[model samples]
Target: MTPSLHPTPATHLPLTINDSIVLQSMLGVGAYGSVYKATDSHTGQTYAVKCLSKTGLDSRQRAFQTHESTLHSLVSGHPNVATLHKIVEEDDCLYMVLDCGVEGDLFYTITERGGFVGNDVAIKSIFGQIASAVLHCHSKGVFHRDLKPENIIMFGQSVKLVDFGLATTEQVSSDFGCGSTFYLSPECQGGYVEMVKSYDSAANDVWSLGVILINLVFGRNPWKQACPRDETFSAYILNNDFLQTILPMSTELNEIIKSVFCLNPRKRIPLSDLAKRVQACKQFTTPEFSASFASSSNASAATATIGQSGVAGGTCFVSSAQREDKDQGDSGVDVRSRA
Candidate 1:
């Protein structure tokens, strides 16, 4: 558990960006700052604006904010990752203008769709894009420590990775504070404040990706945490044969799963390697799965709404309910676990 974050004062509430856009309604509040729905007075375009009060943040928190903003500037041009339009600093606060994910996030879509079962095309398309996005980030020397469903936003027909507050450089020490518990890799579990062990951040991303893929397919995480102590994980590690029972789909996909979920970080497949394997999969190459976005009405309402709720630009992914679970823009560390 982490220490509680100090509160941002109300005096900093209403902020204007670039002297053009004015922040309007409160979208949501997370560990880092409060998100607001802002309107561009000139363009009349709406964007999800994140405002961080510098007054209350400690040195570590300030460093995290700087790191996130820097990473965003470096990794903004990718198709699958969210674009950071501009960043502004004024009145002891930081303002970030970003491309809004009008269709909300994947978590809500998953809840509405019931599950990703029988919708292999959507599953493959989403996963493929995510792989490409993560790969692109890695190529740019950025590693997203927290890659979960909530961090993924549906941008028009594509999905973009958001919230780089926990992002780190490609070269990272094994011990770092990042990732949510359910998504943490085996090496990321034990080390917290006192004990700092070394682990691969890239491998950590892949492990989280595997967990997300499983959730999309099966509707729940296979194990609470990816350690030997977890009963389901222990059984699966004892016998890789469980792959047949859990994900009894294409052998190629299954093979990819095994490679990413390897207990040893050294053995885990690199993002580039996994991307190649994913591209080679025949099951995913079928016409239905080849498209980058899911087709509507082919599956359940829960699945259909993922791409249907909104289009490329509109008020998307703004909810207090979801914001409560976020880790204030850092690696999801809070005074106590949200769960």
Candidate 2:
């Protein structure tokens, strides 16, 4: 009755590989690095993976990475700011995995949609969200050197300030010129290299924010209209003529923008007071504007089901639940991603 017994082999789970997190397609590329849409194998979550090449790992790049690491360490649990999940290194490349925004950058959204959101109440509500995030950054002593629309992401009702690659600490006196030229403060662009040594990064960030607000309202740079040439643009900003052009916006909104973009860094509006000034604006109290703002806020949530992959070669999926929601209203609004 004794029969031959067979030994069983144990099964092991497959190890996760780098390639498994495929580069669906390039989201965007710049001098610093390129970002990609990658799927995490372990959790099947989508992430925006920013990779810094070996050749691009200069002193500036290293310094940026260090500052970003510090910021992430300090504000680890903040919901309004983008969360850094992991930093993966493969040979010479450094990959930063971050929470992917389903709705993508706010700049792209505004640029693609040809509509002016001039309702003051709507502007105030959106501005509050942005200011809250920026104030949090200042409280942490981290100044975002580059705070343009391209760096701000919108997910549902929340807006996160991303691209800390150009961000710096309070003690950092001077580093390489990093920010976009269009958003740079006067002192930052002054001819004297030594002048930047005295440049206050915090105030500079405020100026950039003002420029962003102006762009949001006008959909174009205030200075861009005056000086089409690069040299003229530099001259215009240095002479403070750019301030005059921005004054055409409402008196309250104009004052807020001016306070932030003051040529004298010491006179610039501190992040602590931004929320109060934004609330004081007349635009924040109108019922019609409030309704419009609420609708725009919902627009981001509505587009959440849009595919993370670009329009090149991926299969876009829209669930039945999402379809039903889309059919409820505003089905005519174009949800195309920017090139």
Candidate 3:
């Protein structure tokens, strides 16, 4: 028989979901909640379960949580984004079982593996995966407002973008002052003062991608801020030839970077076009970045064999990387429909 899951009111942790699942240890705390490394007691399969308490969540916080769950579930099957195994909702908390990223986040990986100076291949492969993920998100009308290294978790040669606390749909009313400071686009910088006009989330993501690519190649950001007022940014704005001296990169790469870093959002390459350009760039296929990612298909098959189902009358399985299920909700019905 399936056992009842008990809630720890004091520590706010679920004691155990059933006879099949056991909470092992705390992973880390997020902006909204805590994550735990858990194991399937029956098959010994491991997963990460993020826990968010409903105790004191204000309406705004509740809304964000709902939105995150909605977006995360919608984008779960993408290879470049973390997969959601299943979501277990209790009266006091929401348990999100996600794919485990054992290698840690991108920031730590870069710091430990030595900067990308001679490892151009890793740079291209990693950036390509990220671009693909962003393109997929854009196609679904979901925008990941935050795109910093810390939010990108690495699994050896592969990566999975996480932390959708700041994500929003295209039709939603967006607020100003979102995302990290260093990765902000020119429009994002401008949007702070011009509160009346909302920034394009997709374009802002492209600009941040430019910053990320530059950091991966050069080992540091070119400027502290992307606004025209910033001295370094202003210099680049005035001199079209400045990147050549600073990057020592091929003309094709330089052109791609310039297109992404264009101050005018309208002029920046769309994610669809950027994906093609980046893929076509000969630099991506260079010997250094040719390493292959661990197969998610294999992982999914393993998970399906061991992951538990029939938990409190809910189903469970590792989301397939090739899933083509579309979100059919036209409004606020997303979370309930998916769950």
Worst 10 residues of 2 by lDDT: 327-336
Tens-place lDDT digits, model 3, residues 85-136? 8888877777787777777666555444444543556777888999988888
**Candidate 3, poorest ten consecutive residues by summed lDDT:** 330-339
| Superposition error at 262 for model 2 (Å) | 1.4
Query: Given candidate 2, what's the lDDT at residue 171?
Result: 39
Model 2 lDDT tens row, 17-113 = 2756654545655445656666776678877766666654778767665556567556544676777777776656667677777775656555555
Sorted on lDDT, highest at the top, how do the candidates line up?
A: 1, 3, 2
Q: For all candidates, what are the clash counts?
A: 7, 2, 2
Indicate which candidate wins on TM-score. 1
- Write out the backbone clash pairs for model 1: 31-328, 32-328, 112-302, 113-302, 113-303, 174-198, 174-199
Error of 1 at 178 (Å): 1.0
Model 1 misplaced stretches (Cα beyond 4 Å): 1-15, 190-196, 284-339
> Who is ahead in lDDT, 2 or 3?
3
Best by lDDT: 1
